[model samples]
Target: MVPISRLTVIAATVVLIDQWSKQYIQGHMLPGMSIPVLDGIFHITYVLNPGAAFGILENQRMLFIAIALVMLGLTAYFLKHIPEPFRLMRLGLSLLAGGAIGNVIDRVQTGHVVDFFDFRIWPVFNVADIAIVTGVGCVIYTLVFSTFPTGNQENQR
Candidate 1:
C-alpha cells in the first residue's frame, strides 16, 4: 500500500541521515570537543551518552537496547493501524522507528550513543534524538487535533 511505502521511505531516510550525521561527527570531532556554530547559542559538542535522554541511567546499555527494540516493535504495530489519510501519523511512526533503530545500533556496537548539537541550555542531542522528539510531537498534535472528536464538536455531531 502507499502508506506502507511512504512509511518505509521515511524511516529509511531518517536512519540514513541520522547515521551519516553521527558518523560525520565521530570522524571529525574528538570526544569532549566543542565547536561553536553560533557563539553563546549553538555549538557541536561530541559526547557519548551511555544512557537515555539527558544522560539518565548512565551505563545501562542493555536496558536501553531492550527499550529501543520494544519501541521499534510498538512503532511498527502502531503504523499498521494508522489509516492512509493520516499521513502525519505514518510520518511520526516512521521517524520514531528510525530514530530508535539508529540509537540501538550505536548502543549495540559502541555501548554509547553519539550526541552533538549543543544549545548550551538543553542537554546535547543528535539526529536520532531530534527525529524521535519531533515524531512524538507530531503524533501528539495529531492525536489532540485530528483523532479526537473534541467535546464541543462531538456534541454538535
Candidate 2:
C-alpha cells in the first residue's frame, strides 16, 4: 500500500491545478466566448455545465453536486485499499478525486462546472473534465488488465 500521505499530496496537487486553471479560464474566457488555439481543431471557450458531461441533465446543478460529493466520498473511503505503486491506478484515483472536488468547488460557487477547452468535434471542457475522463480510462484499464492485489484482484488473499 502506498502511504496515504503520498496519495493526499497527489490528490491535493491535482485539485489545485484543476481549480486554478478553471478559475483562470473563467476570468478570461467569457461565456459563449471562443478563442482559437489551433484553427479547425482546438479552441478555448467558456461554458457552464449544470449537468454531467455532454450537458446531460442540464440545469440539474444540485443533482450534479450531489453526485460529485458521493464520488469524492467513495474515492476517499477506498483510497487506502487501492493498490500502491500502481501508477495507473494512482493516476486514476488522483484524477477522480481532483476532478470531483474541483467541480464541487464550482457547484458551490457558481452552481455549475466551468468548462473552457473547446474542440470543434466535441463538447467544451476544462481541466477537471480532462482529469475525470483520463482517470476513468485509467480505472477501466486497471480493472481490465493489471493484477494489483486489492479487493478487486480476485487472487488477493
Candidate 3:
C-alpha cells in the first residue's frame, strides 16, 4: 500500500483505540477516582480535562478547537507532500491527527476530554494524549536524527 494509505490505517487505529479506552474508563470509573494498578509507579486516575496537556489554558474551548483544526489541516496538506524517505515523520503526523480527532470528539460531546492513565509523578492522561506525545516524539526524532544522516547514511562518510 501507499504511504498515505498506511498513515490513514495507523491514524484510524489510534482514534478507535483512544475512543474505546476513554469510553471504557468512563463507564467503569468516576471522575477523580484512582485505581492502583502498579502501586505508586502507575495508576488509572480518571479526570476531565478542560484544557490542553497538563491542564494549561483551562476552559479555552475556542482556542483548543482552533488549534486542532489548524493542526489537522496542516497534517493533511503535508502528508501528501512528504517524500517516501520520511516514513517515520508521516507516521507521526498520522498519530497526531488521530489523537486530535479523538480528543475533539470528546470535547464536542462533553466539553471536556476524558483522561485516565497516571504515572503518579506526571499529570493524568489518556490514549489520545499518548498518541499525540508519541507522534511529536517521532517527528522530533526524524528531524534531529533520521533526516540528518545519522540513521542510514553513515556509508556516505
Highest lDDT: which candidate?
3
Which order, best to worst by TM-score?
1, 3, 2
User: What TM-score does model 1 achieve against the real structure?
Assistant: 0.90
Instruction: Put down candidate 3 lDDT per residue, 1-157, tens digits, no spaces.
Output: 2467788899899999999999999899999999999999999999999998889999988788888999999999989987878888888999999999999988888888998989989889988888999999989999888644346666766
| TM-score pick, better of 2 and 3 | 3
| Alpha-carbon deviation at 142 in model 2, angstroms | 0.9
lDDT of 2 by residue, 1-157 (tens): 7777877777787789988888888777678888899987998888878878788888887888888888888888877677665768777887888878888888888888888888889988877778888889988998889764446556654
List, residue by residue over 26-65, the lDDT tens digit for candidate 1: 9998999999999989999999998888889999999989
Candidates sorted by lDDT, best first: 3, 1, 2
Off by over 4 Å in 1: 148-157
Quote the lDDT for 146 in model 3.
69
lDDT of 3: 0.90
User: What lDDT does model 2 reach?
Assistant: 0.81
Q: Candidate 3 at residue 105, lDDT?
A: 89
Worst 10 residues of 1 by lDDT: 146-155
Query: What is the lDDT of every predicted structure here?
Result: 0.88, 0.81, 0.90
- TM, every model: 0.90, 0.87, 0.90
Superposed by TM-score, candidate 3 places the C-alpha of residue 151 at a distance from the truth, in angstroms, of 22
Q: Could you tell me the TM-score of candidate 2?
A: 0.87
Clash pairs for candidate 2: none
